[model samples]
Target: MRTTTAPGDALGVLETAALLRELTAGLISAADFDEALAQLVRTCRAAVPGVTWCSVTILQAGEPASVAASDEPIRALDDVQYGDDGPAITAIRERDPVFVPDLAGSGRWPRWTARALALGVHGVVSAPVDIDDQVIGSINLYARRPGAFRDRQQLTAMLLAEHAGLLLAAVRGRVRADRAQPQPVAPGDEEVVGHALGVIMTQRGCPAPEAREVLRGASRALSIPLAELARRLVDSVARHHPG
Candidate 1:
């Protein structure tokens, strides 16, 4: 997104630039991800009259997920949006700001549309939030009146999304160490396995399969090679560990 530039409002530009600098510096120092995300939506809604409410859904590990929201009717959309597991997922794949002028008539994400319709919000503008080319999350703006967001409002939403990404990445980087689910280690470590195999090629003087097994055994025992033991094993002159 193009940053706010080409200004007649010198003070506004300075203030905006200052704020951007401050935000960039603190992007990774947010207090809490959930609170920060909710605040982003709140800030968006307050800044734009048409947007009375907002919500944030994130892609966690290639799957759609909702982090936080205002907890109104739109709150229900999370269970499905969590993994792009539902229709609302369309908003995620859509790069341009989506202005749902009328949720009831909007056929996109049928289930999501139905839920939002129940909330009494006539429209919403959702935009993808990106940081350093990575799409971190999306911001959804809700309007009490039908067809509230104009082209200008949509543009503002995109601008809001940029800052949102900075804040979230910062907040999430910290919170993730605590809240993220555990990841498993692959059964066989690639580097050690390959290194062991290479070691066997020189010491075993055998075919690939035999070398692989020899390396496997040595690795499992975590054996340290001794001179005598190393000599006992056959050696291919070309194979050498450069000191």
Candidate 2:
């Protein structure tokens, strides 16, 4: 819950605590709660000095995608979707944190390591973001220098990941409550599900039927109920289009 710095460093425990409080307050009060996730990664970059880049990787239907990144270069995380050997993948799959103090010297994930090295990333840490014992994603931190991340930085990242998880859970809860409310002819559930399907259709450039099918596929792959998956998708859309 605290981060330390050298005597003259600009950041310290007080600053870190203030950042955490700000993030928590924003997530709790924001009308569009999902947008708070993007803020989470940005906060990570600011709170941790060794973090050169930050990204949030969301796992849906057994597929992982980077939903928010601090910089354009960090978008290379999309490539990680192709393989299962990267730090983020490991973190989510194992429900644990993975830290590569020196990406270039690490023996694991040769392909991902090479790609990260090419991007001037020499160290990385990934922490699982979970809710109710289920790991839904990870927060990945990248550094430009070897051994850039130490135990303190890892602890800070983990704390941020915990906050991110709490925010996501809250969003999901809201969506579920909205869907559960009583309604006339067209139930709230169906309405929200339809909206979610339309969102998928637009984002994936597909038709309504195809988007519904995509949702079903993801639901089955991730072992999440269709309605729950729909809620998550709707939440995601709301985050991007807060207006």
Candidate 3:
């Protein structure tokens, strides 16, 4: 989303690999698609030096919405694009990556440009996360200055999208299976749940009792085994509040 003005820098091989490593490790214990996406946004914001904010748009059943956004302006910009038919929407619907070097001067998303300009955002690099041309979502990176992400950076972003696609498929697969029959806690659940609860305690400022109650509620609502439910709840919260 919109942030302070800055220029894009070229990333080296080592840097790129390091970013990939960090991103993968970040989502290792993620519970599902949403959790992974939340981490995806966090990872991009960290890896990209000038990226003061980030946002993601998940298109589910033809409706697109912000799954994770760093700020209100960023989320609102994405929401505007998602609501109408434009290049970003076309790129997503057509399963192609859309790169807008300049948002303010571009007429592609005329309304989007005005809105983005109002909030100080002036560029975008959108990478569609698609599975065999069936786009499930898109990662939209915005910047306050124009001509943000470059061509090679766009390629690296595609790598992120590829990993994200696989991550989502794996997580959603588990969710479907879990939904069919309640899931049981694996050995790693303790750590997963701990991390999740830590995020909730920090973000929501809830006490242990309330956090534990939240875990219990998630378990009952999802019909998951108690421990598994706790782990999932914690993992979900952690991903969105990694800061």
Candidate 4:
């Protein structure tokens, strides 16, 4: 992890809260661990100014895997990291946040940096997802311009990565529960599904039945149970905008 000491203004209280609100909403609405991480990367890419790409790496059964990315091109960048040492791998190993203000002169990870430069990535920030003293993975953010992620942006990335740890912990709990017993959608689950349908209708500009199909399609695509997906959507909206 690269450390820096620079004078800069921190994010405002309300501003930080707003950003966190978006992330928390994403977690609440996600159908499972993978979707939650996907939401995190998407939110970080859009919310963090100057971030061109974002990706999440998690250790799946002791093997590193790039779980989510902001765009397709980011997979290539992540692949380079998986092949050799990169900021993300370093962050996970050190259990700290790493900021590469400029990859042009970086000798720390030559091969990976060269690949990143060729891909038009000039800067990088990797924050470790440390949960209960265990490093689960990392969140990598890339920029097209050097020095794009300063103190403020690095702090934001670190905070979000910390939230990813919490999400992982929740996922572990859910997995344990899932293994304990199969949860069947109850009668009340229909209402949850209805709310999810309404959300899909608005997002897709489709009718109720069409939205229902959309939910069904997503459930099938993600291999998630229909009832579970519906509950996640409703929870995402309800928690984000409580009455």
Candidate 5:
């Protein structure tokens, strides 16, 4: 199926360049890289005309997980990850952009197509976020209408994904260097944080980075320290989903 954008519906090259500049600036000034990733998804949703939602799927430590999503009801991403056949996974695996113009007629990953349709997502475009030769993750955009993403939209998404990949690479490098230095943590706090991350991973079916971001968000919302919030979450999970 062919898709076209109205004259005003698509961003001009100059506008696109300005938006990318803003994103790059934001990434440079962001206090936390994970939070920046969350912001990146939100920016993607705003920059793309037909995008109803956006998410970032990172493959780190041999685990693939949706680390940031613009919407809360992103359970479909989990299905894609589990099935290993959706556009997001394919984009990262192949290190290329994957566009599903019409999910209903795609004839690929039937389960994922059904789930996405049920979730009101009919179109998708996923672009691999790469750093050098490494495929770090993917930037996935979803649309509510079939064939919503046209070539222009795909190109914009690809550009954004490339910018995100560069930022991620810098952030990962900084984190690795930090890890080499001595850091202090309160007694038992690390364990509590780990347990809380695990609980979030189990409950949300997201990756470790995503779970950590969730914890950080909760901490900010509740005006509590991260360790304390983690402790609370661990206790709550134990009470509810006791193993």
Candidate 6:
């Protein structure tokens, strides 16, 4: 099926860039890269309007693995795709976005389509996430309604996948470096970021991703690393509202 082009306003370039920047900073601030990746898929599920489930695939131990998923049960959907010609696999193979606007209308990947439809998934979009020039994976989004991912939605998913590729590269580099020289990590660092996110969300009445963007924006303006900024924020909040 042909992919539709998104209009200028469907998702402005500036907005897309901002999202990528925030996501990059948030990933860098994370204490555990794997858990951060899991959080990323969750954030994507929340950020994208029509996405019913989201998953990220990457090579682990020389084999494809679902590194992160929005919901644990949704991993079943990804499992069906791993050994089949599913959209996610095709997207990685072709290094392009694969769009299945309506699973009922398409005969491709019979196994995946049937499994998806049985689970109330009617639309799927898979975009390739390049780990490097040669290695690639995919970020897959599933929707419950047909035609859920139109021009704008598809573009959003693609942009997210593009940024996810960059983040994965960072993760891979970190893993290699850790294997060479182990680093000590602080306890409760993850909770610091989570607490800061909660504070931001409560203050702005926004979602976790939006709060993350706000935190990133603040970190940028203050010239502080995201993790440090989050720690400071949590400390300040505790000081003022001491229990």
lDDT (C-alpha, whole model) for all candidates: 0.59, 0.75, 0.70, 0.80, 0.77, 0.77
Q: What are the RMSD figures for all models against the true structure?
A: 12.4, 11.6, 13.1, 13.4, 11.4, 15.2
**TM-scores, all models, native as reference:** 0.56, 0.65, 0.67, 0.70, 0.67, 0.68
lDDT: the better of candidates 1 and 2: 2
* Model 5 residue 208 distance off true place after TM-score fit, in angstroms: 36
Model 6 off-target regions past 4 Å?
Answer: 1-3, 6-9, 60-62, 133-135, 182-243
RMSD to native, candidate 4: 13.4
lDDT tens string, model 2, 146-178? 988887677777878888788778876775565
Clashing pairs in 3: 196-234
Q: Extract clashing residue pairs from model 1.
A: 27-170, 28-170, 64-82, 64-83, 65-82
lDDT of 5 by residue, 1-243 (tens): 244667755668799888898788777666666777877887888877889988888776546644688867764464466555777778877888888878888898777777788888899999988754433788889999988888878878888988888887787677546544433448878998888899999989999999988887776566577888888888887788679
Off by over 4 Å in 3: 1-11, 131-135, 183-243
How does residue 222 of candidate 5 score in lDDT? 62
Positional deviation of residue 199's Cα in model 5 after best superposition, in angstroms? 33
Q: lDDT per residue, candidate 6, 55-122, as tens digits?
A: 88765543675457877666887887767878887887788888877999999999888888988889
lDDT of candidate 3 over 107-134, digit per residue (tens): 7867777777788877677777873333
Question: Whole-model lDDT for model 5 versus the true structure?
Answer: 0.77
**Candidate maximizing TM-score:** 4
How well does candidate 5 score on lDDT at residue 33? 63
Write down the worst ten-residue block by lDDT for model 5: 176-185
* lDDT top scorer: 4
Task: Write the number of the candidate with greater TM-score, choosing between 2 and 4.
Answer: 4
Clashing pairs in 5: none
Per-residue accuracy of model 1 over 3-49 as CA lDDT, tens digit each? 34334322345555654555454444456765676666555655565
